[model samples]
Target: MLIVHVAVTVLLGIGAFFLLVGSIGLLRFPDFYTRLHATGKCDTLGGGLIILGAMIYHLFQYPETLLVSAKLAFLIFFVFIANPTATHAIMKAAYKTGVKPWRLGEERR
Candidate 1:
């Protein structure tokens, strides 16, 4: 039980850290595509970790809530699928519209 608690804490902390990194990347990256790449990957992992942590905690605290746990599991699966798909769709649209990639030495405001 103690070990499980510790693991949940660690997972939640790591998840928060990754989420912070994703947000930073989203804000600091020079271009839309780069930002999307950073947030798409990092945010996915971050969210997964956080959800995993929550599920673990819930599992320990309320083992009877099988329905809730299953819902969380489904949420995890949905996020894993949807985030990257959405990113890809946005990138595809941007490319089709001829949005130029950012180049070195280009001034962007």
Candidate 2:
């Protein structure tokens, strides 16, 4: 049980780190497309890991309660489906609107 708790805590910490990185990337990245790449990939992974940690904690601490477990499961499922779809939609819209990428060789204006 102690090990399980520690593991979950570590996972949550890692997720938080990823979330912070994503937020910083969103703010610091030069272009919309780059920001999207960071937020979409890093934030999604962060959220997923956080949710997984929560689910694991719940499952271990309340083994007899199905309600919490069920809710956590639903959360995982919803995030998994919604995050990528939302990212894809945003990227597609950006592409459609001709939001160009920042070329590596080009100097920042």
Candidate 3:
């Protein structure tokens, strides 16, 4: 269906856009913490939306593969939970290890 295709396209596009934003932030941000923050938020949502698009597409295009969609849903959930948790853990580790945040006029690490 045209509508279904459009919806899938939109989700995929938004997901890709977020992914791009995350990558740019990773490259452009001044410091490690900020980069981590960028990727953590954008990547989780981007990856989740991409997977959601896949799940939706499969649900409509292959009705018998409900199991596939269910599995993808689990994957989406895992990414949503795991990425942020992992990011926080890493940030905590960085803080504990005395990895300093960037201040103004400092050279990039």
Candidate 4:
């Protein structure tokens, strides 16, 4: 349906936008922790949105591919669960390694 197409397009576009913003933040942020936060949160949301859009489009376009749809659903669920957990793990490791948090007006040690 035309409405479904439009909605899918919009969702994909927004997802792409969030991914772009997250990438920019990763590069531009001054500190490791800030960059991690930006990329972790934004990438999770962005990836989820993209996966959601694809799942919707596939559901409408290929009603017979129930298995494929289920796989996509699994991917969505996995990314949602895994991305943040990985990010948190990385942050924890960084903390354990003595990577200091950035403070305002203080030089990075």
Predicted model with the maximum TM-score = 3
Best model per lDDT: 3
- Whole-structure CA lDDT of model 3: 0.96
C-alpha RMSD of candidate 3? 0.8
- Residue 90: error of model 3 in Å? 1.0
Write one digit per residue (lDDT tens) for candidate 1, span 1-109. 9999999999999999999999999889899888898999999999999999999989999998888889999999999999999999999999999989998888652
Q: Can you rank all candidates by lDDT, best first?
A: 3, 1, 4, 2
TM-score of each: 0.94, 0.89, 0.96, 0.94
Please give the lDDT score for candidate 4.
0.92
Model 3 residue 45 CA deviation (Å) reads 0.4
* Candidate 4 residue lDDT tens string, 41-74: 8999899999899999999999998888899889
Worst 10 residues of 2 by lDDT: 100-109
Q: Please provide, for model 2 over 75-103, each residue's C-alpha lDDT reduced to its tens digit, 9 standing for 90 to 100.
A: 87888789889999989998999878889
In Å, residue 59's CA in model 4 sits off its true spot by: 0.7
Cα lDDT tens digits, model 3, 61-98, are 99987999999999999998899899999999999999
Candidate 4 is scored at a TM of 0.94
Q: What are the lDDT scores of the predictions, listed in order?
A: 0.93, 0.88, 0.96, 0.92
Per-model RMSD to reference: 1.1, 1.6, 0.8, 1.3
Q: In terms of TM-score, which candidate is stronger, 2 or 3?
A: 3
